[model samples]
Target: MNIGFFNGEFIDINKAVIPIDERGHQFGDGVYEVVKTYHSVPLLLDEHLERFEKSATAIHIRLPYKKAELKSIIVEGIERAGLENAEVYFQVTRGIAPRNHLFPDVPPSFTLTVKPARKIAERNYESGVQTIIVEDDRWAKCHIKSLNLLPNILAKQNAVNSGNFEAIYEKDGFIAEGTSSNVFVVKNAVLYTTPLTSNILPGITREAILQIAKEEGIESKEERFTKDFLMNADEAFISSTSVEVLPIRTVDGQIIGSGNPGEMTKKLHQLFKGLC
Candidate 1:
């Protein structure tokens, strides 16, 4: 019962609704957000919507619908899908245009789809997941959730091919983030992660963990740390809208902490799930 939305109407998820000359299809000229729902309610929807609008504006693409209209679309799409847990993905693109490098004077195209959320393995959370470190090769504007993700996918595929769960990006000898998640390390009971910058996406789950840490009085710092620091941390993990707070067990084949899901990682994830 997955649902798809394009232009102005809902359709089957498999429908080929986008035109061949669509700017998004041609040049990845768009910004997208993925919202996860639990018990038929999207979590942190308002924050996601705010970030979505900011990303579209950053890329100079005017969204076809207002915030209210977009919310209605999402809610209806979720209902149509009829799934208690769903992954709602939506994007605003620069619209259809002939082959050209310059911007076209056409309206933006908005597309959305709602489907069952992908489930990560439960054992991975219990044992934690392995990761490989890769050099950050993406553009400088990583803060904007743009559709250009070639480098990210490449690194991610490399990690998967190497039997790792995720790829952590190291820029200038320090950890920037994971290919699709934010990196965090707990050292001597203090949490640390890369600060907000043009180098990493401001992850919703990462922010929630930080806020939860503040509420629980767990010390946290939003500052860059070296790869060596991460490798030797007491505990480490990655966070995203999908993974929530998945623990990291290894970096480059070296065991992290006791090579198990740390107590704090478990507690933080338990608290994060409470929000859902």
Candidate 2:
């Protein structure tokens, strides 16, 4: 019974299909955004949509509809899903055309899908999660939320194969981010994370955490830190729309600090939950 918005129409998920020649499918030419709903309301929707538009613009893909129209479609699809807590995923791609690397003259195609939200295991929050550091092999434009996610997928799969919760991507020993989240470390009671650059996505949740920290008088810095610093930090965590704030207890089998979620991490997690 789930409903989805596909190419300007709302239809049953089963009936929503894309043409084989669609650029998103054929060339991975698309941008996407995932918004999580709490009490049937999307959190930081405006920020997410703004980032979506920026991503599309970065890749020269024009959105088929304006932000207001897209927001309406998201609301309609979420209502059809009938889930108080859900994840709304939407994407825009260059329309279907003959297989070619060159830009096509056709209009763009946009789709929205809503589904029940996935909750993280309580154990992960209580006992904290383990992760491994992997070499970042993604392209230069990691800030764009494009469909080209093969590198991220492989890194995440590597984490899964190793029986870990996530993969922390590092470029030349400097931590960039997680496979699907932003990375943060606490040292001497100061929270530090990567700078806003082309190396990492400017996560909405990450921004919220920093804002909360500022309001709470918690010291934070946006600067790159090396693997040695991360391994020896007092605490570490990852943030994203889905995970919110997840504690990192260990990395590459090396225990971080006392191998437990730090006081700052817990405080920030509570603040983030309140916002949600």
lDDT string for model 2 (1-276, tens) is: 356888988887888398889999999999999999999999999999999999999999888898898889999888888999999999999889999999999999998899888899999998789999999999999999989999999999989899899999999879999999999999999999999999999999999999999999999999989999999999999999999999998999999989988999999999999987
Question: How much is the lDDT of residue 135 in candidate 1?
Answer: 92
lDDT by residue (tens digit), candidate 1, 68-184: 999999999999999999999999999998969999999999999999999999999999999999999999999999999999999999999999999999999989999999999
Best by TM-score: 1
Instruction: Evaluate residue 245 in candidate 2 and report its C-alpha lDDT on the 0 to 100 scale.
Output: 94
Candidate 1 — which residues are off by over 4 angstroms? none
RMSD of each: 0.6, 0.9
lDDT for position 74 in model 2: 91
In model 2, how many backbone clashes occur?
0
TM-score of 1: 0.99
Structure candidate 2, residue pairs in collision: none
Evaluate residue 261 in candidate 2 and report its C-alpha lDDT on the 0 to 100 scale: 88
Among the numbered candidates, top lDDT falls to 1
Q: What lDDT does the true structure give each of the candidates? A: 0.95, 0.93
